[model samples]
Target: YTSALHFLNTKIGKGQIFLKFDTVEHDAEKRLLAYVYMKNKTFINAHLLKHGLAQVDTTYPCKHLAKFTNLWKAARTNRNDAEKE
Candidate 1:
């Protein structure tokens, strides 16, 4: 997680990032889900997912559930493919 966060920080590199919270209410743990968008309009969550650095928590409902699900599947597939290679 630390290495992944460091990679994100290097990529962000003084650039501005905008966090857009999901419209759904916070979970029981009071954790608010959000999407991190870079200045260039890139979705940071997608990047993390693609790199296999993040996972989808289907237990909680969110606006990006479908997207996250797809991302998670793709990440798994990519990891498997790389391992096979």
Candidate 2:
């Protein structure tokens, strides 16, 4: 089972990419998966990540999936703000 996941969404030359990995089981099919998405390359995930791949720009599982919800709100707000401007 994947302990953590990584992803990013931003404008201007998205950095990073999704990488496959194995979990504690160390099985072929059930390899751990990690994706990076940032220029800083501050990769984030259950396990340590490699260079180039970036984290999701959020705290690990903040409040249990909280990061996702927070990101969603931030995206919505950004969209609204962009329209206004």
Candidate 3:
């Protein structure tokens, strides 16, 4: 089990992982989604569903979704959109 855990930890520890989530529902599910981070761009998709990991709200937590979202809203979007036009 330790080896598997080690493998999991190493697999998802290499990317700019982010977690934005909502209120946890089930205890078991919460245990799974409580910790989520990326080890790499490809692997670690499952770590976000495991214990001792980075847990984030998968959905908007309130009525104002944007305000509670991790959605990227930087000026870079404006520049890119302008460049396209």
Best by TM-score: 1
TM-score of each: 0.81, 0.31, 0.27
Cα lDDT over the full model 1: 0.83
List, residue by residue over 13-55, the lDDT tens digit for candidate 1. 7899998976655777888677889989999988888778888
In model 1, which range of ten residues has the least summed lDDT?
Answer: 21-30
Clashes of 1: 0
Q: Name the lDDT value of residue 15 in candidate 1.
A: 93
Which segments of model 3 are wrong by more than 4 Å? 13-16, 22-40, 43-85
Q: Which stretches in model 1 have alpha-carbon errors above 4 Å?
A: none
Candidate 2 lDDT by residue in tens digits, 1-85: 1322232233223555544332332334654434433454443442222222323333222332444445555656666788899
Off by over 4 Å in 2: 1-41, 44-64
CA RMSD, predictions in order: 1.8, 10.4, 11.3
Alpha-carbon deviation at 48 in model 3, angstroms: 9.9
List the candidates ranked by lDDT, beginning with the highest. 1, 3, 2
Tens digit of lDDT per residue, candidate 3, span 1-85? 5655676656644436655443553354345332234534432433322332322354523332343232223334544677899
